[model samples]
Target: MSVDPEIFAKVKEALIDALGVDDDEVTEEATMVGDLGAESIDFLDIVFKLEKSFDITIPREELFPDDILTNADYIADGKLTADGLAQLKERMQFVDLTKFEADPQVQNFGNLLTVRDLCSYVATKKA
Candidate 1:
């Protein structure tokens, strides 16, 4: 899916400002955690910036979905069960989970959200 350039610019700006990353580093495919060096704390600032910039209320569950990750029934041996993956997929429609599906380790979930996914989310909110 092609992200709206305006949305992408705002998202890129938010990310750059929140994560203190160089402009060149915030590519569409860059993972928030892995590529942009965004820690969990940075998400708060990023979300706040996005909400302010776009005038949209962002529910925490829509982005984080921490409940699913912590649920005992959905996890086994540090990996997400089939049902858990399904739930995650349903919740995170903006995210591309194809690669994550191959290795559904719970730890890897944090690195799954990319810049493009974030832009898509903002576009949905604006719509």
Candidate 2:
């Protein structure tokens, strides 16, 4: 799905304010953790900023999905099991999981979310 330009602008602004990143660095493909230097602790501020900017409530599970990551039923051998990947797909339709699906390593999941994904999520929430 194409990202809404207005949503993208808001998301980019929120990411910049929360993460202290440059405007040029907040590209659609930039991973939240890898490219934008977002840590686990930064997510709270990011979510708060997004909610305030968009006037929508964002539940923690909708963005983080920690339950699936930490669940024994969804993980095995440092990677997500097939069922786990399926669950992630179901939960994070706003995210493009193709790259993460290729590896499915729990460690790599931190880098899965992109600016574009955040914009899509906001779009979904606003809808």
Candidate 3:
């Protein structure tokens, strides 16, 4: 799926608002778990938020393993899965209710600006 800067911006903002993190720290290469302190439950919320915000269902194996969403070795490997491509099939549709549910991470969502999140955000938003 193609990248949409506008949608990426929204995801970035959503993460920043949710996580209470600074924008500069939320870079594409940043590690969401080790560097960002994302717990398993928090990661789950991130996954759900990603699906809701962008309207896509990430494959379970690719998105969640050991119950977390991270970028530990993604930059070197490109991507561990194709969830971004899946989300990219539909871009213009925004699921408003996804954001309002207030998942655990929603209270601390702002700082999850990893490459994977960016790709998923852009894909889902642009879908």
Candidate 4:
């Protein structure tokens, strides 16, 4: 699912407006936390901006699920269960969980999400 250039631009604009980042920094491969320096709270602002700009409602849980560590259905003891991984993969299609699949750590999962992921999600919502 290739993102339309126009939608990509809109997503970038929303990110820039919400996170106050330079245009060059908000590339498709840039992770919101690692590359673009987005804090946890910044996600709420970004989602709000995207919803208004695109005129689409994005369910918060679909984009950022509750902490898996605390969710019993997603974890067991200290490891991610198969059902949990499947659910995560479904919700986070934009993320490359190949490496994480081998050792699914709760803390690193959120960082795996990239700017392209958010853009793709918004594109889907608009469609």
Candidate 5:
């Protein structure tokens, strides 16, 4: 599915507002769970914000009840790049932390990186 250019801007804005992170730090490869270190509730909140911003129906399973993606899936998706499609696919699978220093709230997300969170967050994105 094709996403809008503004979707990135909106989603990135939501992320920064909700999570107190920098927009530049939120690449498509950045999973809400792993890279941003979002909690289950934080993720639920992110899902809500993302849904509202995108005006898309992100299923509950996509956010809470699922398999999502795996570690190998991360390699498969590649990392988030400037290309929206690639970044979306990558963000669907994993979160890149190369820009974490710019966002201190990112440090607060460290506890949310369970393997279950990792896979589920990715799986949700693909969904």
Candidate 6:
């Protein structure tokens, strides 16, 4: 689905205001943690800011559910099982899972979440 540029701008501005990231750093493909330097703890603040800025509620689990790495249904022997990977890919469709699909590492799935993913999620909520 095509996202509205206005929505993208609002989402980007919210992320910048919340995360203190430079305009150059908040690209569509920028990984939240890897490229934007977002820590795990920063997600809560980010979500809050986005919600407040957009006047919409973002479901926590929909964005970044916890315990996937520890859940047996999602991980096996330090890696994501085939079923687990499928589930993750379905849940995080906004993310580019090419690398993770090639390697199938549960540990790295979280790393696939990018700034564009956040924008897409928010845009969907608004829709």
Q: How are the candidates ranked when ordered by TM-score, highest leading?
A: 1, 2, 4, 6, 3, 5
Model 3: worst 10 consecutive residues (lDDT sum):
88-97
Candidate 4 scores a C-alpha RMSD against the true structure in Å of: 1.8
The runs of at least 3 residues in candidate 3 whose Cα sits more than 4 Å from the true structure, single-residue gaps closed, are 1-3, 67-127
lDDT of 6 by residue, 1-127 (tens): 5656877788788778867989888878788888877887788888898889889997787788565556888777778878777777777666667787788766676687877778888877887
In angstroms, give how far residue 43 of model 3 lies from its true place.
0.7
Clashes of each: 0, 0, 15, 0, 7, 0
Q: Extract clashing residue pairs from model 4.
A: none
TM-score of each: 0.97, 0.96, 0.47, 0.89, 0.45, 0.86
Clashing pairs in 2: none
lDDT of 2 at 55: 92
What TM-score quantifies how close candidate 4 is to the native fold? 0.89
For 28-125, candidate 3 gives per-residue lDDT tens digits of 55657656666666666666776777777765444433222243332123332334322322321322223322332322323433555556544643
Query: Candidate 1, which segments miss by more than 4 Å at Cα?
Result: none
**Per-residue error (Å), model 5, residue 1:** 9.5
Global CA lDDT computed for model 6? 0.78
Residue-wise lDDT of candidate 5 within 12-126, one digit each (tens)?
6767777777766777657666566566676677667777765666766533422222223322233222343243334444433334323323233343233333334434454
What TM-score quantifies how close candidate 2 is to the native fold?
Answer: 0.96
* Candidate 4 lDDT, 56-83, residue by residue in tens: 9988887887755458888876767888
Question: What lDDT does each candidate get?
Answer: 0.93, 0.92, 0.49, 0.83, 0.49, 0.78
Better of 1 and 6 by lDDT: 1
Clash count, candidate 5:
7
Tell me, by TM-score, which candidate is best: 1
Clashing residue pairs found in predicted model 1: none
lDDT tens readout by residue for model 1, 50-112: 999999999988999899999999999999999999999999888889999999999999998
Best by lDDT: 1
Candidate 4 weakest ten by summed lDDT: 61-70
